[model samples]
Target: MAMTQAVQPVIRPATQPTTPARHVTVRGRASFWLFGAAACVALLVLLPLAFTLRQALGFGAANAAELVFRPIVGELALNTLMIVAAATVTSAIVGAAAAWFVERTHLPGRKIWAVLAAAPLAVPPFITSYAWVSFSESLQDFNGALLVVTTAYYPLIYLPVAAALRGMDPALEETARSLGLGPWTRFFRVVLPQLKPALLGGMLLVALGTLSEFGAFALLRFRTFTTEIYAEYRLSFDGSGASMLASILMLLCLVCLALEFRVRGLSRYDRMDRGARRAPARYHLGWGKWPVLASFAGLTLVTLGMPLGMIVYWLLQHGDAAITPVEVSLPLVLDATLSSVGLGLAGAALTTVLALPLGLLLARHPGRIATLLERIVYLAQGLPGIVIALAIVSLAIQALRPLYQSAALLVVAYAILFLPLALVSVRAALLQVEPRLEDAARSLGLNRWQTLWRVVLPLAGPGLGCAAALVFISVMTELTATLLLAPIGTQTLAMQVWADTAALAFAAAAPYAAILVGFSLISTWLLMSLFGKTAVLGATS
Candidate 1:
């Protein structure tokens, strides 16, 4: 969902000659070093996929088939597929409509509405699940899971589509209007076709997200592959069963990725000439204004209001004034908050640092090797955190025993899980740093390392900060990997929320949930301030 900046055509004076290549040997050597570094990072990122494949293969084919073909597997598959399909469709419709109203129509306070639409990303899906379940036990089923995930993930589609709407050229729509086409016809025929890439990309993200989601479904008691895999691992330590399930989930995600990629095939919709383009005229709501406002009001109420209202309700219930009051400990809450902040900072720094080499390579030295390495990094996006945690646990126990159950090991898992997030920001940041600046630095007798340190890094400082902050927010809210891999006796806010919520102690969970939500909101605001609305897309997806 990261909006790509258009490439400005480089115009040179007619008298200026084409620049000669200088320091070809130095560049060649630098490229080789960068390639080696990036390859190592890619291999580390590929470990989970490799491990899953190995475990599945080690389970004999007949036995694996039997395990996968059982009635329970079929049931889980159906539930997972149903939820993924429903959520993807629901999110698309809701997201697209929200984007249309916010970006294409004359909605009052459109800017505020845009921010509010993406705000759900700040609330972890599990917290949303906790809120709904605490509100009523009857919601512990398919419908509950659908509602929670739709609210949580619609922004995955909305952000990208809205960004697309903002970037699109209005010339085609104007021509269609001139030809007497109705608004609906123009939208479907002209606008929809142009938005295909962003829309499909967003839908792909929603499907993959729903398919791999763990905590939310677990809390909701919705039996999906992720939940089943977690259960198999935790209850029976059934590595083969869990690996087989994970493999199936990964395959589904891959299919979505491939489908979106194939459908989007080399499409370029950028303007061809250096012509001035004006913003598209907003559609007047007219008599529909009141209804449209009501719709937006209702949306914000459900998506933002409900979970927040529930959290506050639970917080207030933590005393003798309420029935079944639970005593909330301020010390425990503060400890967990501090722990979460510490771990988030550590994980953010480590992940961003690990991602730097690959991002640099992709931005400055793109080729077959760089592209392949990038694709390998992105393959992690398809893997759920549970699967990665499983792989890391197994690898650490079997090979890296000393690091097993260590904070360092957990941080490594965070790096692998969220590397793409950091990479996207890093690459985008580096891309904005003109190569001409580096060339000039070199011409001034600065070495490659010195040029990057003194020139490039400073220029990319804010983006790098954004990258780290994005990862920090994710680490703070991340439940799956932290649950499986955090060091003994360590309790973060996410763990506390999950623990109390799982025990049906919603009041006890409120403090942690509130702090977590607060951090997310603040961090989200910082991201928007730094990179605008499109940056929020990278924060989650």
Candidate 2:
């Protein structure tokens, strides 16, 4: 998950003075301690990357050159870049259009359409690929990969752009219209420029997702570096080459982070006036309304309805019968559900806990150490699940053999991968808990630890809950790491779905998919309802 600059704390008015000197000293000491702890956690996050680097570098220069100079490497890079480029552009266009129609236009059923458009997010990309491929034999290619990723990830762009659109000051658009600019001209000249930050934030997310994606690309037969890496590991047993490819992917991730930063710049979009901002005027789309409605309906059908419908269809379908009462084998479904929930909860808690020190440090300190630690987490987030899994697998085999393939190690991998999601939420929540509140607690004779326990934690509860919910949903739907590192003989709901789908047993996979989607939707609902009010939806995986 990437951090959005939009979520930074608002600058107080000139009347509010800066921190006093003594207070600054106390904060500095606290920050140093927090920084130390955060650095340790960040190293854990980077352990996999470090391992990858070692593996890549330890292979002699000739081997490295051979790995790096191959035609396939160039092909994979082109494929990945193409997918990222296409998906980012397409998702932005689609997500922005959907947001504009639902948020800025007088579209009928806007609320319903908005929810349904975003509902595809609950359907994991791999699941969407499975559904699409199952529905048609021809979807096992680049076109299918592009389509699957665009629908699956467009919501990443949609939610942020929608939020930005909702909060926008409408005075510019009104002025542009008054100057005789057409709607399209006004949108391009005035509105789109203003939405650059949100758009870039969403674009960066889509890019990162595309870079790290393994399942959808793999299932669709689109050969990206992530899939190739998996193939290298599983089929060729070429750890060195896989690590090198991962290193290149990680470098690409860094380049993306830098590019987004440069494009977003340091512009502040805050309204200067103290007056109450009026709601944006809705455009009355008379003749065009039905067409827009139909487009959104089709979008929802492909993205959300089709996958879900197919899951249910296979769940009920039997030979020569239109519908059948599918008897879900209780033992299998129950055990899988339980395992999924347990891992999800454990991963959520572990990730959130690991995230806190770093989150607090960044919120309170805002220095090089804090920035570096946070970026390390972001880098880890950008790496593929397979890379992280391999890194953890390597680490466990070398340092903790007994924990190899154990649930404990799996949870550790989850924490490593999803810790940024928690950090972003926790840091945003911590920002809301003002320093003065903690100061008041101290004035009331509470110790720092007690103040954090009584004051900050309670105030940040919603953020923590949202973080947990996000992580739980992510863990429940995660397929890559679960496929590799899950304990022997263990099957989570996702694992079962992947297994059955791999075997082309669509009917057998249907129940697991349904259950997984149900849990994911519930958790996603919790995330949006809890954190939407707080504007903490940054870089969700």
Among the numbered candidates, top TM-score falls to 1
RMSD of each: 7.5, 8.5
Off by over 4 Å in 1: 1-22, 319-327, 532-541
- Count of backbone collisions in candidate 1: 0
How many collisions per candidate? 0, 0
Sliding window of 10 residues with minimal summed lDDT for model 2? 319-328
lDDT of 2 at 258: 90
What tens digits encode model 1's per-residue C-alpha lDDT throughout 377-429?
Answer: 99888778888888888788788999998999998999999999999989988
Task: Evaluate all candidate structures by whole-model CA lDDT and list the values in order.
Answer: 0.87, 0.85
Q: What tens-digit string does per-residue lDDT give for candidate 2 at 1-63?
A: 234444443444434555566567766787777888899899999888889888878888998
What's the true lDDT of residue 90 in model 1? 96
Clashing pairs in 2: none
What TM-score, computed on C-alpha atoms, does each candidate reach?
Answer: 0.92, 0.90
Evaluate model 2: give its lDDT. 0.85
